[model samples]
Target chain A: MSRELTVVGLSHHTAPVEVRERLAAAAADAEAFLRRLVADCGVDEAVLLSTCNRIEVVTCSKAGHDPRQALTRLMVELSGIGAHDGDGLLFAMQGREAVRHVFRVASSLDSMIVGEPQILGQMKQQFEVSSSLEAAGPVLVRVFHKSFSVAKRVRTETGIASRSVSVAATAVDLASRIFETLDGRVVMLLGAGDTGETAARHFMAANVGQIMVANRTFETAVDLARELSATALPLERFRQYLPLADLVVGSAGGGQLLDAEDVREVLRERRGRPMFFIDLAVPRNFDPAINQLDGAYLYDIDDLAAVVEDNLGERRREAVRAETIVEAEVDQFWQWFEKLQVVPTIVELREYADSIRRGEVEKTLAKMQAISEEDRERIHQMTRAIVNKLLHHPTAVLKGEGSPTEESRLLSAVRRLFRLGDDT
Target chain B: MHTHTLMLFVASACYIGASLCYGASFSRREAPGARLAPWLLALGFGIHTLDIVRDVVSAGVLPVATFAGGFSFFAWLVVGIYLGLQARLSLAVVGALVSPLAFLAVTLDAIVRGDDVAVPQALRSPWLPVHVTLAFLGNAVFALAFAVSAVYLLQENLIKSRHTAGLIRRLPPLEKLDRLSAGFLMWGFPLLTLGIVSGGVWSANSTGHFWTGEPREILAALTWLLYAGLLQLRLLGGLHGRRAARWTIVAFSLLLTSYVAVNLLRLGTRHGLGLAG
Candidate 1:
C-alpha cells in the first residue's frame, strides 16, 4: 500500500483576512463539509481546521493517489474565489513536508503570533470533530495525538508561551507578580481613554473583583461604567476611592493627576497593601516618584512598552528552541510512519506461507492412513516449524531499517515474486 | 566511625545535595531540581532526627549543651519548621535560601567537635533543657523569619523599581512574603519571651542571683527589647511592608550577633556555657 499524507491551507502569512474569513465562514457546518470531502475526494481520512487566522485541511490518502489537487479545488470552492486567484493564496505540502506542516501548525510555530496558545486548542477541536464524525481514520488519529505531545513538549521545554508580548497583557502580568491572584481585587480606571480602558479590560478578564471608572466628564464615566457593568465616580472625588483600589489604570490626559504625596497618603490608608498603577497618559498622570514608595508601583506608557519589547525579544529566542524541538519530533514521527509502510507486506507474506503449508500437510495426511495419530500430530508440528523458519529471514529483511525508496522497492519486488494481489 | 558520627555525616551530605538542587532551581530553565530538593531535605531531616534521638537516649540528656550540639540542634529546628511551612506555601526560593544555612550549621557542628560532650554537673538541671530548647526553637523561628524578610525586601524592591524580569516570578508575591514574615515574627516573639524567662530562672537557680550584668546578659536583653519593640509597633502602630521587614531583619541580626558573641566567642559570660545551655 502507498499511503500518503497531505495538507493544504491558507493562513495570515499567505492570504488576507478577507480570504481567510470567507473559508472560515463557509466551514460553519464543519462536520458535514468534512464528511463530504472524505466521501468525494480520494482522502481516506480528513480534518478541517477553520479559525479566523487560518483554514487548513489535513488528509491521508492511499493507493498511490495524491489528495492535494482535490483538496485545493475544494478550498477554492469553499472560499468562493477564482481558481487562478486561489493558486497563490493556498500552499500545499505532501509526504514528510505535510506531516511537518501539521506539527508546526498544531504547535503554533506557524501562527501569526509565533508562540500563541490558541492554535493547539483549535487543532484539537478540529481533530475531535473529524474523529467523532468518522472522517478521521487511524492514521490521522495517530498524527494528531503525536502533534499534541510535540506541542506540549515545546511549551514546557522552551519559554515560548511564558511571557506576554502586548502592553495591556504586560500590565496584567506585572500586577499578578505583585499580587498572587487578581481575584477579588479592585481596579480603579482613572480615565476612559482607549489605552487605559484596554488595560482595564485585560484586568477584568483576569477576574478582578470590581471596576470603578472615573472620567473627567461624569456622563462619560457613567456611560463607560454602564457598558462595563462597573461603578462610576466623579473624577474630582477619585482620590477618596483610591485607597479601595488595588490597581489604578490612568489615561486621563493632562499633567500629573496624582503626585507622590497623594499616593503616600493612600498607601498609609491601605495599610501597606501593595497598589499597582499603570499610567497611560501622555504627560504622565501619576508622579514617577510614587514608584519609590514602599507599597506603590508606578509604570508609565514607556515602561510598559519597554517591558513588552523585552518579552517579545525573549519569545523570539524561545521560538528558535521550539523550532529545533519540532524538527527532531518530525524526524521521529516520520521514521515510525516509514516503518509502518512495510507492516502490511510483512503480514501478507506470513499469511501466504502459512496457508500453503497447512494445505500441503492436510493433503499428505489424507494419503498416509497407516500413520499413528501421535505421528500425525508430530508431522503437523514439524511442518509449522519448517514454514516459520523458512519465512523468518525474509520477514526480518523486509522490516529492517532502510531508505523510503528502498523499502518501497523491496516491498514491490516481494509482492511480484509471490504473485500477491495489487490491492495493498 | 561511630553510628552517631556516621549519621551526622550522611545527614550533612544530604543537606549539601538539597542546597545545590534548590540553587539549581533558580538558574535552570527546567527546574527538575526543585522537585528533587524537598525529597533530599526530608531524607536528611529524618536521619538528623534519628541522630538527635540517639544522642538524647544514649546520653540521658538534651543534645544541646556543647557548641557543636547547639549548632546541630538549631539546624534541625530550622529544617523542621521549613518543611512544615512548605506544606502550606509554595516557597521554593525560600528553600534555596534556607538549605544552605542548614548545611553551614551542620558542617560547622561536624568540624567543631568530634565526640559528644557530657552535660557538666553545674549545667545539669531541669531548667537547662527547657531553657535551651525554648531559646533554640525561638532562634530557629527567627532565622526562618530572617530568610522570609530577605525575600520580601528583594521582591518589594524589584516590583517598586520595575526591574521585574524572570527572577520576580520565581519569588513569591510581595504581599505573601510580607504576610509570611509577619506570621513568623508573631510566633517567634512569644517563644523568645518564654525562652528568656526560663533562662533567667535557670541562671538564678544555678548562680544564686535573679539578675546578672554580664555582656551576654546585656546583649540578650537588648536583642529581646528590639524584638519586643518591633512586635509592639506592628501590632499596635499598623507598621507593615518594608518597615516591618526591615525591623524583623534588624532584630534577628542582633540575636545572631549575641549568639556568636556570648556562645561561640565566649566574650563576657562568667560560666562559658554555649547557646543558653
Candidate 2:
C-alpha cells in the first residue's frame, strides 16, 4: 500500500490569462470545492489555491488510491478546463515533486514576477479556507505549515522581496520611508502630465489622506481631479495648499516653480514635519537647492529610475541565494514526509503481533480448568515476557534506518506474515 | 572560580550568544533570526541583572565603584534600555548595532578587572551613586542615539547613491529612526547635565574647587558643550537629518574619549581611597 500526494493545476507558465481567469475560483467557492473533493473523491486531505495566475489542487489520497484522475475530472467539471483540450496547459505532479511545487509556489520562486510578496499571502489565505472547511488534514497541515515557514525563510535570508523592481514602485516605497503609512497623509500632484498623473494614481491606491491636483491650466487640473475623485487647484494656489501636502509629486513642463525660499517658508509654517518631493519634471519644477532644507526629501525621475535599475540587478543576485534556501527547505520537508510514511506501518505490524499473542493466551486460560489464581497470574506474566522478547528484534529492525528497497521489502513481508490490513 | 564569578561568566556567554543572533538577523534571508534575537537578548539581560545583584550583595557596595565594575554597570544599562526600546518599537535591526557594543563593554570589564579596585574616598559620598547612575544612564541613551545616527547616515547614503537594494529594507523607516533618535537625545541631555553638575559638586567638596583644570575635566566640559549646541540646533534651529546625525556621532565620540581618559587612563590625581591596595 502506498500513500501519495498529487497536485493538479494550470499556472501562468502553462496557461494563458483567459484559461487562468476562467479556472480561478473565489475563496468561498474554492473552500466548498476542497470540501467536496475530500468527501466525494476519496481524498484524505485537500487544499485548493485559486488566484489570477494559477488554480492548484493539492490532494493526499488514502493508501492504494490514485487522486490524479479524480482531481483531473473535477477540474474539467468545475473549472471547465477539459483534460483533452487542456493537454499542453494542464500540469500534474505526484509525491515529492508535488510537495516541491507547492513549496516553490508559496515562496514566490515560481511566480510570474519572481519574489513578489503577494503569492505567499494568497497561499496562506488558501490554507485558511481549506482548514476552516475541515478539508485540510494532518498531511496538508504539515505541508502548508512547512511552505509558510520556507517562504518566510526565503524572504528574510535573501533580499528577493525586499527591493522594488520598478521606478514607480520605488517612488511609493520612498514615500513609505518618510511616512509609516500613507493612510492619513496628503499627496499633492504638482503637474497634470501623464507621469505625474500615473504617480498620483499609485498614491491613491496606497489610500492617501487626500489627493490635490494642481496644473498650469485650471481646466486640465479640474479634468484630472474629477477623473481621480480628487480636489483641483490652479497652479498659483499650490503654495496655499503646500502646508497641507505631506508629499508633492512634480512633473510639469514648467521651469523651477518652487525655490529654496518657498520651501523654507513652508517648512517654517509646517513646523518641520517631513515632506517628500518627487520631481518628475525634466526641467525640475522644485529647485534642487530645496533638498538642503531639513526634513525635505527630493527625488527626480532620473534618480528614481537609477534606483530601480540598480535594485533589479541586486534582486537577480538575491534570487540565486533565495533559490538555495528554498531547495534546502524542500529537502528537509521531504525527509520528514518520508519518515511519516514508515511510522504507521511499523506501529500496525507491532499491534498485529500483540493482538495474536493476546488471543492465544485467552484461549489457553479458558481451557485450563481449575488452575490456581497465582499460577494463572504467573502464566500471564510469562506470556507477556515471551511476547516482548519475541517482538524486540523485529521492532528494532523496523525502526532502524535502511535503504528504501530493503525497508519496503521488510515492511511488506511483515504485513504479509502478520496479515496486517492496509486500512490501518 | 567563585559562584559569583561563574554566574558573571554565564551572563557574558549569554550576551555573546545574543549578539551573534542579532548579527545573524541582519544577513538572514528569513524572519527567524530577528524573532529569536530579542528573546535571547532578554534572557541575557535577566542573567546579567542577577549577576549584578549577586555582586552587590557579596561586596556590600554598588559594583560601580571601580572602573571595571563601572563598565559592567554601564553595559547592563545599555542592554536594559535597548530591550525597552525594542519592546516599544520592535527595532530588531537596531539590536545588531547595539548588542556588539554591549559585548565589547562586558568582555572588556571581565578581562580588565580580575579583582575589585579600591573605591575612591570622594566617590564614597552619597552623591557618588546619583552621579554615576545618571551618567551611565545618559551614556546608554546616547549610545542608542549613536547607533540610530549611524543607521541614519548609512540609509541616507544608500538612498542618495541610489543603492536601495540590499540593506534598506531591513532598516526601520528613515523618519522613525529620526524621531526615535531625537527622543533619546532629549531624554539623555537633561540626565547628562545633572550628572555633570553633581560631579562638579562632588569635586568641590573633595578638591576645594569645581574648576579642576584637569585635561579629563576640560574634555568632559567640551563634550557637554558640543551636545548642548547639537540639541539647541535641533530644537530651536530645526537642524535634522544628515547634519544632525553627523553632529551626534561627533558628540558621542567626544563623550567616550573623555570618559575613557578619566577612568581608564587615570588622567587626574588619584581619587581612589586605596583601601583594597
Candidate 3:
C-alpha cells in the first residue's frame, strides 16, 4: 500500500514558548531517535523534524503497528520525560496529512521565526539524514521533492513574501524614517530586564549618540548603564531626560513597566519633539492611553508581535496560495502516480480492442467476393474507430480509479466482463 | 522553398520542445524524465543545422536577403550558444531564458519572411552577408545579456526580501548573472564593431555614406560607445555586476531601437532610403 502524506503539530497558536522550547528536538538527538524509532516500534521508514517552533515525526510502517504510540514513545525517550507526559502535547498524523504537514513546514508555515527562511535548510538536512539512514523510500522521496516544488511555486506565484516586518527592528526603521537620523538620538531604557537590554543593544548597534538607563533600583540601573555606555539615572529622575531621549524602551523589574501618568509627565516635559516609546513587556508596562498622546508613539509587546504576527498572518493568508501551489504539486505527483497505472491499462485496453477488430475484419474480408484494397483498408479503419469509441470511456474510468485498493476490484470486473485472461 | 519551409517548421518545433522540457526540469528537480533537455536541445541544433544548410542552397540569393531569414539565423545562434554554455556549466535556468529568446528570434525573423523583398543592388555587396549576420548576432547576444540582467535584478530583490524560495535555491546568484551578462557584452561588442565597420566600408564603396544614410547608424554607434564605456568602467573602475549589467541592457535597448524600430518608422536621411521606405 502507498503511504499517504499527512501532518500533525502545533505552533505558537497552541502552545507557549516555554512549552515549545521543551518540545524542541535537539539536532543530534533526532538522528539517534530516528534509529530508535525503527528498532522500537517496527517503523519501516522515518524522518524526524525538530525546529525551534515545531517538532514532528514522519514515518511509514507495514503490518500491525501503532504509530501515535510509537511516536509518543520516541518523544519521551529523546526528551527524558515521563512517556505519558507528552501524550497531550505530541501531535500524530498518519498518511496524506503527514505529507501535507512536511510541505507546510518546508514552506515556513510552521516556523517560530515566521518567514525567517532557515527552516527549509533544516528540513533539507533532515531529509539528507533520513536518506543516509535509508529511512525515506520512494514515496517519501516524492513527497519531499514535491514539497520543495510547491514552496518554490508559492514564492513565485504569490505576493505573501512581498510584505514582511521585523517589529523589533521595524521600530528602528520607523524611527529613522520618521526622524531621518538615529545618529544623535537619545535612547532611554525604562527597565533593566532582557527586553530593555535588547532595545539598548539595537540602539547601540545603530550608533545612537547616548543612552540613559533608568530602572527602579539605583544599582541595577548603574550596571545596565555601564553595559550600554550610558549614564545611570534614578527612577524619580527618569522625567528629567524624558524630553531629552528621542527613543524610550521599558524593561523594568516591576510587572508594569511604565504607567500612563509616567508617560503624561514625560510628554508634558518634552514640549513635543516626537518621542517613540517601545514597550517590550508582557502585560504592558505602560497604559495604552500613552498612545493617545499627540507627539508620543507608544507601542507594547503585543503591538510589536502584532507587526510580526501580521506578517505571519499574511503568510497564513498566503498559506492558501501555498496550499494552492501544494495542490498543483500534489496533483503533479499524483499524475505521475496515476499515469504509471494508466499506461498499462491503456496498452491492455488497446490490445483487447485490436484482437476483436482484427477478428471481425478477417472474417469479413474472407467472406467478401469483391472488396477493393482501398475498400478493405477503409473497412479496417471503421472497425478500429468503433472499437476505440466503445472502449474509451470504460478504459478511462478504469485507469482513473487504478489505486491498488480500487484496482483489484476493477481488474476482476474487467477480467470477468471481457474474459480477458480466458483461453477459448 | 518547400524544403526551406519544412526546415523552418522543424527548427521552431525543436525550440518549442526544448523550452517545454527545460521548464519542466526547473519545476521537477528529482525527475530523471526532465533529462530530455539536452536531447531536445541537441535536436534543435540538428534541425537548425539543416535550416542553415538549406539557406545556402540558393547561393547568391542567400536566405538572409529576406528579413525573417536573417533574424531566424541569429535566433538559432543565440539558443545554440546558450545550449552549449548550459552543457558545459550545468546551468538549467538558461532554458527558462534562452528558449523564449530563440522563439522570439525565430518568430520575428520569420515575420517578413514570405515577402522575400529583393535586396537592392547597393546592399548586394560581397561583405553584406558578413555585416548583416554580425549585427544580428550581436543584437542576439545583447538580448541574452538583458535576460541575464533581468534575472540578476530579480535575484537581488529576493535576497533583499530575505526569502529563499526553491527557485531562489535553484537560480545562479546575482553576481554570476552579472558576470555572464558582462561576458556576453564583452564578446558581443567587438563583433558588433566588426559588423559596423564592414558595413561602413561597404556603404562608402557602394552608397557613398554610412551614418549619413541612416541617422540611426549614428544612434547605433552611440549605443556601442555606451557599452564600450561600460566595459572600460567595469575593468578600470571596477564598475561591474548590476551596474555593468544595467549599462548592457540600456545599450541593447538603444541598439534595438536604432536597428529595428527606426527602420520600421522609415526614418532615414538617404536619398535612396526613400526607395526602400
Candidate topping TM-score: 1
**Predicted complexes: DockQ each:** 0.60, 0.32, 0.01
Q: Which structure is stronger by DockQ: 1 or 2?
A: 1
**TM-score of chain B only, all predictions?**
0.95, 0.92, 0.87
Where model 3 places Cα greater than 4 Å from the true spot, the runs are A1-424, B1-49, B59-62, B89-94, B108-111, B115-117, B161-167, B208-213, B269-277
* Candidate 1 per-residue C-alpha lDDT over A1-424 given as tens digits, one digit per residue, 9 for 90 to 100: 5477988989898999999999888887987788778877878888888888888888988745767788899889989999999978999988779888888888888888889999999889888988898888888899999999999999999988899989899999998878878999999998887886788789889999999999989998888888888999999999999999999998997778999999999998987788999998888899999998888888899998988888888889998999899899888887678677678767777787888988999998999879998998999899989988998898888978778668767877987797553444
User: Which ten residues in a row are the worst by lDDT in model 2 chain A?
Assistant: A23-32
TM-score of each: 0.90, 0.72, 0.45
lDDT head-to-head 1 vs 2, winner: 1
lDDT of 2 by residue, B1-277 (tens): 7555666677777777777887777765554665677777778778778878876666655687666677778889988998887777978777887677667766766666655545555656776667777877888899889989888888777665556656777778777777777888999899888888877777777777887787766776787888888888888888777778888998998888777777766777456421110
Model 3 has a DockQ score of 0.01
- iRMS for all predictions? 1.2, 2.8, 16.2
Tens-place lDDT per residue, model 3, A284-365, is 6677777665445676776666656656666667667667776556555655554443555456657877988899889979
